[model samples]
Target: MLRWLKERLAQQNEAVATAVAAADLVDKRYAAGLATYLQVLSTQNATLVEKRQLVDLQSRALSLQANLSRALGGGYRPEMTMTANAHSTVADKS
Candidate 1:
């Protein structure tokens, strides 16, 4: 889960950088008379929307992971699976 979180953070950072660059490009293009203000607005709006989505998703995933970690007693232990299954079998026999 930590690895997954790290990867997600990296992706979000990269995406944000790209979006910023794109926004800058739109501004440059508009100033150069190659594009209109409307085009600039559209590009910026799209990038903002995408960044918002990425933030939302990352936050949700991190929240879920944090809750899970807390519930699992800090972090995952592969051997806990066997213990959980054993408990389930014992409870069933009761």
Candidate 2:
């Protein structure tokens, strides 16, 4: 869970960086050669909307990680562990 949260943070940073760069380009071109303010409004709206989802996912992942971290050494790890039983029929007879 911690690893998944870390990966989510990295991905969210990348996405926000991309939005920042796009906003910068839109900033430079808004006045002279580009279209009206609608483009800026649309881009900003989209960036904000995308960020809302990323923020929600990030919050959930971080909260889960923190809860798991707090559960360490409390004898509750097994309660959250995920195991696969898909290969149980093909056991090795040692």
Best by lDDT: 1
Q: Candidate 1's error at 58, in angstroms?
A: 2.9
Instruction: Tell me, by TM-score, which candidate is best.
Output: 1
lDDT for 47 (candidate 1): 84
Query: In candidate 1, how many Å is residue 66 off?
Result: 3.1
| Candidate 2 clashes between residue pairs 3 or more apart in a chain or in different chains | none
Instruction: Tell me the tens digit of each residue's lDDT in model 2 across 1-94.
Output: 5677678778887887788778767877896667568878877876887688688987897678567667674434534443323244345332
Estimated TM-score for each candidate: 0.61, 0.60
Candidate 1 error regions (>4 Å): 73-94
Error of 1 at 57 (Å): 2.9
Task: Tell me the lDDT of candidate 1.
Answer: 0.83
lDDT per residue for candidate 1 within 13-79, as digits (tens), equals 7887888888899899999999999989988997897789788878877787778878988865556
Error of 2 at 64 (Å): 0.5
